[model samples]
Target: MRRLHTRTARRRVVGALTAGLLCTFGPAAPALAAPAPTVAAPAAADVAPTVDDGLALTPPMGFNNWNSTHCRAEFNEDMVKGIADIFVEKGLKDAGYQYVNLDDCWALQSRDANGKLVPDPVRFPNGIKAVADYVHSRGLKLGIYTSAGTKTCNEAGFPGALGHEYSDAQQFADWGVDYLKYDNCNNQGVDARLRYTTMRDALLAATGTTGRPIVYSLCEWGQNKPWEWASDVGHLWRTTGDISDNWGSMLSILKQNLPLAQYAGPGHWNDPDMLEVGNGGMTDTEYRSHFSMWSIMAAPLLIGSDLRDASDATFDILGNKEVIAVDQDPLGKQGTVLSSEGGRWVVAKEMKDGSRTVALFNETGSAQRVATTARAAGLPAAGAYTVRDLWQHKSYNTAGTISATVPAHGTVLVRVSTDAKWAKNPPAVELGLDGGLLVEAGKPVKLTSTVTDLGRTAAAQVSVKLSGPAGWAVKATSPAGTHTLPTGRSLRTTWQVTAPKGTPADSYDLTLKASYRSPTGVRAENVLPLTASVVVAPPAGVSSLGDLPWLSTTNGWGPVERNTSNGENEAGDGNPMTVNGVVYAKGLGVHADSSVEYYTGKACETVTAQVGVDDEEGDDGSVAFEIWADGTKMAASGVLSNAQAAQAISADVRGAQTVRLVVTDGGDGSTSDHGDWADAQLTC
Candidate 1:
């Protein structure tokens, strides 16, 4: 049993994903997919893979014992009851702290002769059933932890339920457990799917008509790629190992889970372990960052600290309504990191109310200037926005951009309200360029920019101006052809860009300008002053097919599907379907049991590719491949049994404009499902 409760005593943390993931499915896809799907929002990748319990409409907010009690986590009913007292007394319950979870070490040294887990008699003389009743009296829920493995962490001389799923679950239901935090320790190498499912089924069966269903939390330390399928089994699944009370540990887990946002929905959340606020190891600013990040991600805010003696800063952070509001936003969309620099990061979240939140973080030795525009933070282009600095408790207004100087390890979290009322009449006509641009010097490569009218007023005479390297020619036309936009609608246009033959093998930025006149007579001008990188051949075509914008993916935040992805896959987080950052035609490793579609834009005669399962994670999982052209199945690869080598991929995409690739868990779920779509491309 790996006793994670002793986190403070642990030397190092496990499961920190360093490189970040790109959100679009497949590798190199951008988060902002071709605007509008050009027709409707692209179908979201497979619905959540968890069971439908209708619980966790938003991630739970609560308190857990492990981080605070450590080895003392054993069946100490009084301690739990005391925390329950604090919950009501300290305004936590009113602030939304409900569950009082008893993490590992709560069970007795051994099960009774009938094979039911027993609370330690000495520590819990009143019994767990009584404790549950007491917690209920406080208007709070009760939770307990057990392992799927042979023994729970901190063994404590108890035998795990290894083979006793039904009995234990029935026993807990009878004891009135409102939630179950099932850990993974000493499982004797049993397949995680069976063990977790066994318990899930047991819990379902054990519930009597009057019994409320338990909120199941799977704590396998993210090793089995649970995000791809955890929805059906548990309310929330831990995406990484334990969270320690330190900056690095907290940030590591945060970065790792960012890319898996799309996998979470109502009742299903991506767990990043527990929050370590007020744990005495990190500064208050760091704690705020930890809290804010978790909230923005819509993660369960299970604080693992001594609530009985929490300090003022702790109370201030724990009770911040604005920050918590963002987490509980009805939209339920998890925030993603928009951009990151040396020690600066900008994170953004789109809310249900149509407002957006942007968090600027500085992780350096001193204070630093961090800035971002509404568009860059993933917000719709707005002429002005109402900004509320959450931590500073100040509200202000800004035009387009929000900039601030933040202290080391600190964050400036602001909520920006960009209602249509705030829309700049000429709303710089939202524009974006797509596809991997790797054209040979003398050849002309095509480009497309998605233009949308973000304002309430219709606009006309919209024009897009593009400038390439000197002597280079770039041509662009509006998607609507007439260079106009109907309010709330979008148009996608094409561009033919060519570079001079003498341009050496280097990269240059293609500068663009978008302008339009609002019906109100205001020249709404927006400059995509952003430079588009146009790579000059050679290394750019490492693959036969052009890749999506590296930032796109199944989850936003750009998962570490490629070596270029900002984050790496930490072992304990899950098996890497795509591994070692190998540059596949798509992202790094295909996410286990997940699929991403690429818009071909242009029709192709046929598509052929070299594909393989990820070799880095060994050959434990398998993937089934299928290709669809313009919504028709073109080819299928019966489950590729080995992830260590290449599999030839071919699809009859003749004259089709969109090609989609789907990889499944070869029947056994996603164990070892690392995959790669190498050299994927269209024969234009």
Candidate 2:
């Protein structure tokens, strides 16, 4: 399953721009700093006819074993059957998931005497047809994988369908295969379209003989701009490379796929690879965003995690029916960018019932308010509209505003419509802070929160309460309870909030909860979180960053460690911070797609660190280290691998409010990508 895990350099295409998609879906967000990918359009006469077998009316949702098991011994007939059983027992089948697809390494390295592909006897003792029969018995379809080249992507080098497409296709049809994931690997330098189209024609012929139509999926990694010509060739074509279980990989793939919304429809789709939820490489918040954005883009939603040991949180994300509805909408229209600025993105998708699914995405490192209007979301002008928060499972009425305070790498998905049934739902109340709170330990700060009724109906028994951590005192300065709040009216409450003495200088969450009831007496509650900083100014002279408190820290796989290497995806699980055989006494160890921010207080003059891929991962890790001072990139270590020695980097932080250290995957999947900032220090 090398094609499913390995990532190569992105091919820069120089061809015709999708002007129609840009005009219809809006332009790419400048804040992402990614240019739209271009492709050359072929002449009408030469374009291959797309598959029209009436399959994949919606982007296929299923489970693939490659991401979790790869080529491990666990990927056998029992594993496949167990997953199908989970689909039926755990509500996945009822959630609209159908196909149970297997990736590479499912076949023997050598074919049989008849030149037909053979399932690995040890992995599938019952043979391919028996396993397919078991899956079909569960009322689910089964899919198989192979390469268009001479050999598959696995290290075993299984035989591919390059010259034996008809024979392999006939074999798969005979085995009752319902889907095929055709990969690009070891192709012997053949043209991409020709190889994929040949298989498409072979599958058609085999289907014509057996009357079993198999869904065709092309995994070419977007080298040839498949979207421009593969519409009639395959049911779905990958628009980018494989996705890693990290934020940077997910975000990068999203940016690449976001610009190609116009090419997606009922029968054809733009595949951005499989889902990476519950892989322990990211937080639950990030996973939700990953799921939401994929659904919004109308990409295939293949579960990449092993379901046998999935956590409840993972199941909650994968089992959200409302979010799945957006992906399966009969309209088959993909979501497009409405606006993107400063790491805040607003994407909207038109549904079949005159509704729009809007996703407020925050790509920044901190929580921020992201907002858009109904008109901007492509909703018709109305005096009042309904906004349903898909994740929160709450409905609110809005005059037109669709906004939320989204966490870092988080998404707030909502459906906006003029449906009248939403009026019976709870009144939409939102909590907002008047200004930023920066307080000292043991000092009381006056924090004000404004509660607004955005719903169509008035709210009764509206009470606002402010809560904080233990040892912190909270006293209301204004009336905490309001008898009634009319529509469009707001109630402001000031709170005397204090942090406990000896509190560390870090970001803390202060919540403002508003409890109210609709005119019909339905109880409703809204909780808004505010991130306040407890500052302890650094002393004069140079200080080690490990000794100082950081404003915030996020890591790809594990908790950012001080004076250690990121040993595993857990807190307090790390070795001494070592880079290229050098042990560091103090610094930060993190994984790729990780960031650590310090409150410089506009006092630090310079920040320095010795950065590289940690030696714990041997010579396999690849990463890029960057230093940002107040949103300005001051220094960068371009693509440092574990094979290289550590490089010293310094960034001028004079007069900057915050200093952020970032490490990203170096054009590869973030497997074993352990990054270290050795001897990190700040000078004031």
Highest lDDT: give the candidate number. 2
- Per-residue lDDT for 85-120 in model 2, tens only? 999999999999989998887888788898778889
Taking all chains together, the TM-score of candidate 1 against the true structure is 0.57
Write down the TM-score of every candidate: 0.57, 0.81
Point out where model 1 deviates above 4 Å. Answer: 1-50, 73-75, 208-210, 419-684
Clashing pairs in 2: 49-232, 50-232
- lDDT per residue, candidate 1, 1-684, as tens digits? 133222221111111111211000111111221211111211233223346767778888888877767756343878889999998988889988789988765667777887678887777788889999999999999998887755565524354566777677777888888898887654555577877877777677666422667889888777788898778888888887556565545665777798988998788899988988998867787899888888888899998888877998998999898899988887888988777786688888998877788888875433455778887876676556666678757444455656665555678788887754543334424555564344557778787765666444566887666677778887764453445677656567788888777676444656556666766667655434333333332222224443443211332111325422122233223233343344443433454444454444444566676666665534445777777765577888777766335667787766654566666556554423556666666565
Q: Evaluate residue 285 in candidate 1 and report its C-alpha lDDT on the 0 to 100 scale.
A: 74
Candidate 2, residue 480: Cα displacement in angstroms equals 2.9
The candidate maximizing TM-score is 2
lDDT of 1: 0.65
Give the range where candidate 1 is weakest over 10 consecutive residues by summed lDDT: 20-29
